[model samples]
Target: MDNENNVNKYSKEEQLNESRVNHDDQKLTTNQGVGVSHTDDSLKAGNRGPTLMEDFHFREKMTHFDHERIPERVVHARGFGAHGHFQPYESMAELTKAKFLQDPSIKTPVFVRFSTVVGSKGSADTVRDVRGFATKFYTEDGNYDLVANNIPVFFIQDAIKFPDIVHSIKPEPHNDMPQASAAHDTFWDFVVNTPEITHMIMWLLSDRAIPRSYRMMEGFGVNTFRFVNGEGKGRFVKFHWKPLLGVHSLVWDEAQKLAGKDPDYHRRDLWDAISKGDYPEYELGIQIIEEEDEFNFDFDVLDPTKIWPEEIVPVKPIGKMTLDRNVDNFFAETEQVAFHPANVVPGIDFTNDPLLQGRLFSYLDTQLIRLGGPNFHEIPINRPLAPIHNNQREGYHRMTIDQGVTSYSPNSLRGNAPHPTPDTEHGYAHYTEKVDGKKVRERSESFNDHYSQASLFWNSMSNAEKEHIIEAFHFEVGAVMDKQIKERVVEMFNHVDGELATEIAKGIGVAPPQNPGGTGVTASSPAVSQENTNQVAATRKVAILLEDGFNHHQVTQVMEALKSAGVHSEIISKNLGMLTGVDGQQLEVNKNYVNTGSIMYDAVYIPGGRQSVDNLLQQGDALHFVNEAFKHGKTIGATNEGVDLLVISQVEGIELAALDSQAELVSKMGIVTIRNAGDMGTIEQEGYFSQQFVSAIAQHRHWKRKNKKEMVPA
Candidate 1:
């Protein structure tokens, strides 16, 4: 019943360990051929003496260890990847001639890398930044890379400003004060100067940036691209990946705490979910706009800082992808796998989006230095399932040997082999869109309207979401030592919304900007709000606290009911092992007070028993467990003596319905307590209690409930 035992039941860790095949597995001996004993340890002179120069073992280990680390990505250095397959829901022959899209039965192998854009490899995962959700699909024709992010918008419109934005967000050169954080003077100054980043800044400050789990958030190809059909017809398209579990996020405080509690929070969530058969699923959705109707929308399609609102051009769910396997080796598979937007099939093509254009160069350029050569594609994880044939050869780390002396085209000796195939043969043909412009460093006038979409995002958020955004802005801006930078940020964001600027100003102790500007755009997209997302209790963790002499039968029944609804329940007691029930039943303990905290789980449950209640009351930490759960707006259920803890804790206006009294205690309120067994039975049987609990959990916190007691309970 311990975490180790529960983890062993899944065997995911064992499978991961087995997947990592060391060089010793091939039975290859050392150059000396004197069968080696200790591969993990280097040979020492004598009892941890200076490493001997003649020690081949020590030399080999040090040589390999020295080269263990590859160059971290210039951007998105911290990343985690998984293996999956994509299956189209139906054929889309009319839209595109791509074989992968044309065949509904074909399952395309995919490797997806979820990354933090600004952090280094060793940085924390729960930072306020955009998450890179890049997917590489190995189709029959070639690999199609859908390089994307959790946010639909980018920080800038043109690729030229990419380096500038990146430099601003990165740690300052003078002292490198902040690591993996944008809440600094440089970042604010850049934002205030470049208003185009307003929309993405709004998203970065929202809870969406700090996702509860990578499996539960949405991904978007931030730039527009074109889809070419067999007939040469083209349509501008934007890709989206909608998670099956819907979008969920952690409270800012919780996210920060989790960074310390578990730096691998997102990675562990993904591995654990897949290992337990809860495969992460995402549906491939596309927003298609006809070539002729491209100019029909009010916003510019090529602007990377804007979104084609789903309300205007609805996303057509085309395919589904499920990540069923974890990586074999972090360095060989996850780290070596290269993704570039330039990797496209016959049907897929790029647009004139400048940011996308720059990424096309950046991805390939970074791989050459990071992976040590142009032959990175030969890496097992990056290899295309389809056959490869070409005259190009002889790069660093070349693993393949060309048979003949014909490494170039136009050679009769090679029978003109590997010749270029026509477009009809499913060859990659670029879209033939006419373009005529003088070479100049300038932005399109159409891309000038930056504040419109930013305002639209502000208008779309729910009240609770707005509050969180304001708090986020306050926390970030308040961290800046420069007061002028904070004032400038408030003034600049005033264009997005007056209320937003005012709220942020109030929290940061700055004067609200007078007469905040507006873009006169009244558009709003409801899909941007998390409150409208699908809510479920499936896979949500609920902690059940119990002690000796507890009402085991009632607790067991409640736990079973939760499990039947797909809720994960963990029993936590003061000690590990087993606790005896009132009826002499032994209940397994999943966690002890010393090992777990209230922040680890989604909700808390307490069972009614005289001895258990008395024991819990005596333990100060146990009382804190209830208070913290309540502070988080999690549901609390108690029948008999369990209710006593709530009373002793002095919860304000604590109301309990008398057994069989038939009286309601403030309908649809923050807290609920049932006295009668029959009422509890009705609540459980009808699933009303479960629904209420799930709703409370989704709300995340009840800001309405104010704690009145002055004395701090210790």
Candidate 2:
């Protein structure tokens, strides 16, 4: 199914396609719709002479081309987006009157953009950095934008520090040496000085930073919001988007290699998935607490740097979003679509979180400049489904021409048109949360306990996860030229965990801390760990290694099982073309050893054939591919003479099935091997060896296996 679009009668698609222009079979024309001929050459005095000044066509064409580009976002410049619809599981009329949440039957059209925070428009997609997961919903009330990030918490508690943090993480401005990276002196210096960044830095260093794909990571609002009921009551709420596919990440080694192998890796993954009808799905969840219980938590709910742990305020699944369509044009829809946190509908209001409050002003101001004035909301991608009113007039790029004689309120000529709807009606009414605080440049004392939550995050990680965090710290902090900054960072993180700091210090050649203490908050928030998320093999990509003269029946049997198990498999060989097996079965090779690497797949399989196995053993490219997959802790499987290739590959101390008489199938660790199997099961139900391989892949990665002794060059 190329598109499952027929399953949904989505209104958003109707609106978007209304403006779509297909130039097929159409005559070329100028901007004024005047037909043109001979556009190949400019209107010139002669064949090789200067252009004529009276040629209006050339002037119009060149002028438009000159102004084609717009300013990319200062942050989140490189982005990929998709069209989707959101529908709630059930109505939440009691808690909030937001129409989108009040009906399970309605599908609200949405545009979601996934991006990297620090990189420029041309940066690699797989860089180790924070990802932005902002969604714009064309709801009936208005376009509500949920500007979010992959990390649940943020680097700073207040919005004033956003500039400082972004400036620090970006490459040192003087030299601009390291592009799309935070491995520099400025970032480390910022971290050591701002203790409020403690918790978020831990998250930044975790595997979460290097998501396997946009379809496989979690997103958070990173701010406290309000859910106002129709009865004029409110509750504190935090938003979350949990991917249906389990949270997964590429190892640092794979991520670094992928940057060179494919800078558009994540973007291509999303586009391909949707194009193939394997639409990415995410469930919208909300963590709500009563307005009266705001003071019940140890940390301030308004602090952007603190997370309301799921165990404490459980995430109630409210709705699901599915991205079923790719954009027709990237620049028109994805790039120009403006998103602002303040673009909320009725029954939804903002909290007093300093970050949220400042963003309300900053996001609008940014669009004014980037999209060229206040008319950005008039853009097709940013327009709302709801009707537009008010006396506001447009400025630059204004498309609307007012048809009214009187544009001001209380004008007799226009009969006082577009009268304001009151709270009794459907008009938006801001929540009446009383506020009285002294004007001072200070953070609340409640936001002071940053180390506690940072400690909570460290303790919650699995051993392998913790090791990755330590390694990330070593890589990031060690790159700092100033030894003093590196040492200060280690000492600062000593507050999160002494062992974590010690391990990082050892790797970076920094001095061990004189005193280290695990922040007194030792309680682990298990829900924060990726190890605790869902696990499945659905939609996983597997590379099937094959060559001419391979066992056709065995290959068919294994592939059928993988297909039935919802795994995507591709045939790879030394060259791209057709490969014929001994039994005359032919397979088309889509990718070759030189083009595709082991880092691109979730698992690998090899079917036995004397000619194929013999040829593969002699090729360094083929051998390195298998060894790299094993070193990355991915599942490996082979059958009959294929087992000989694994043995010959000689991946150091790693174990493989022997050739001697034994059971037909042998499962050693994550590697499944079979030999001398006379009776093969039906394709529907594969043999034990194939089943074992599939099961191993379901576990994502074999983290427990120690590959230090069996390391292979990747």
Candidate 3:
């Protein structure tokens, strides 16, 4: 009992180490712990003939390697995870009796997994799909998994239609073409047929589909849940995870380019952020409604396809979660960790939302087959901080060692141990709500109005955001071979907005709908727009474009200023190694032209030197780097002779700084440049070049460029 208490309060890191195996200084051996002599060559007849079948070492090695992999998840197969802790602002004893929510001093250890829904395990990280943000909190009561997604709504209202939507989004069966993308014929066909999926389809076509980084996206539990208090009263609630950094996304061109240049863009961003101590943080918010007021809204409170507008029911942020540690091993921890919506503690219970009810049963059933057994909860990543005990035991992969002869409960032979507790104790109690409904399998009548909220989503998008949505629809529906499917899609979205349907019809070669109904509800939720999010320069990566004989004096000042502001800068050149500046000072090149591209970075910067800029003018890759960054709405900065490259790149969106050949600084539309930088700390002075450049980088991207329709060669 003393030893148990010593490790009882173990954090997730300490608990995970109990199952972690270190092979650092150990000798190589077989699975049975037998020392091996050589593994390079297999046993054969006379060293060159057929291998001997009786060779136990060769057979065993080949057999294990062949069967090493288990089944991947049906959805959200490609994922990355990190370890973190959740801290509440204050006790929420009045709202709910949840132990973790009632304590402000205690930090609950957690594991968070981020993923793409349509892709396989081998898919790219920057795909245009829903991103899963599942979190498992190892609290004192038990493991509570808040399964969520980057988007606040879902594609289907009923659970039975889940399999159908997934099948349609997957590659067509006849020819398994278009890996890890939903821009295909079958997907569009399903969207037009499933009228209930209008709201989700609008989101899937918006900028939210392509995220800039996992650290800068919002997460939402896409189902209505119940929060039960100590007095047996229940309140309807929805979970939200608002990122501290802000909700940001990549342009379609940048996203597609990154798929080829850097497939692990989001995963690498998250890993580098934590490794450099720039931890990602998010706040836990809940939108709650009293049980009596549930039926007072225009839309159904239990509908999975609808979102309770922040104006109607404001989100009350009660806690914050910070991710500070990366997983030690990907497969052992991230892959093996199983999350279920059913893993809830006391005071957090389920509701009668049909989609939520179906997930409770589906998640548990899928884990058994995908994880190979029912004992997956024992895996280190999924194990809870609280102790577990039960009477029935001994399933596949069971690790517990039971000494007693008795396995059943309520028996005098084993002193009738492991007694149950009522609601007064720590035992879990399900919320008791009066229910009277027919045995019909039909959906609720209130869940039938789907186009109204879909129109609300369209009405809330910015002009630029609306353009992106129309472009996305053109790309997704124009790929369809069937003319009927493409036309059906155009007509279906006409209910959302007139211009949206007309623009999509023009691009896809279909007739526009005449009378497009724009759901006359003049309400827009500002919370759903990314234009209204927190922005900062911290953790942003910028590529400093340079060549030999660059201006060290000016570049050093910019670098120092950026570093102080928590911005990461990497030197990109034609080749690797040291680059000598005009003043004999050398700068190390972290990335080369062939190894990196503009899509992987947030901004591009160039320092000034006459000879260096002249040399860079000769390289085609350097010119393309500037144009590509400009086309993607990224910030671009240059000083002195470096502005010459910008002019040669033919990007016309910002005013240059100059006065009759005299040195002057200019800042316009996220582009900062100077005719010349004179001395040390000159750019660092207040209201100077460095300040303007860093502030532009903090803007994340220059989305409001003047040349919004200009085409670049790159």
TM-score of 3: 0.89
TM-score of 1: 0.86
| Better-scoring candidate (lDDT), 1 or 3 | 3
Residue-level lDDT tens digits of model 3 in 66-119: 233359888888999999999999988888989999888999999999999988
For candidate 2, report its TM-score.
0.89
Q: Rate the local accuracy (lDDT) of all candidates.
A: 0.77, 0.83, 0.84
Q: Considering only N, C-alpha and C atoms within 3 Å, which residue pairs clash in candidate 1?
A: none
Q: Return the TM-score for each candidate structure.
A: 0.86, 0.89, 0.89
Cα deviation of 346, candidate 1, in Å: 0.8
Candidate 2 lDDT over 319-422, as tens digits, reads 99999999999999989988899999898898878667657656776777788888988899988888898888868988888887777888878778878888
Best by lDDT: 3
- TM-score rank, highest first? 3, 2, 1
Please report, as a residue range, the 10-residue window in candidate 2 with the lowest summed lDDT.
41-50
**Evaluation by TM-score, superior candidate among 1 and 3:** 3
- 2 against 3, candidate with superior lDDT: 3
Name the runs in model 1 displaced over 4 angstroms.
1-70, 650-672, 678-684, 687-714
Candidate 2 residues lying further than 4 Å off, grouped into runs, are: 1-70, 650-654, 661-663, 678-687, 707-710
lDDT over C-alpha atoms for residue 204 of model 3: 89
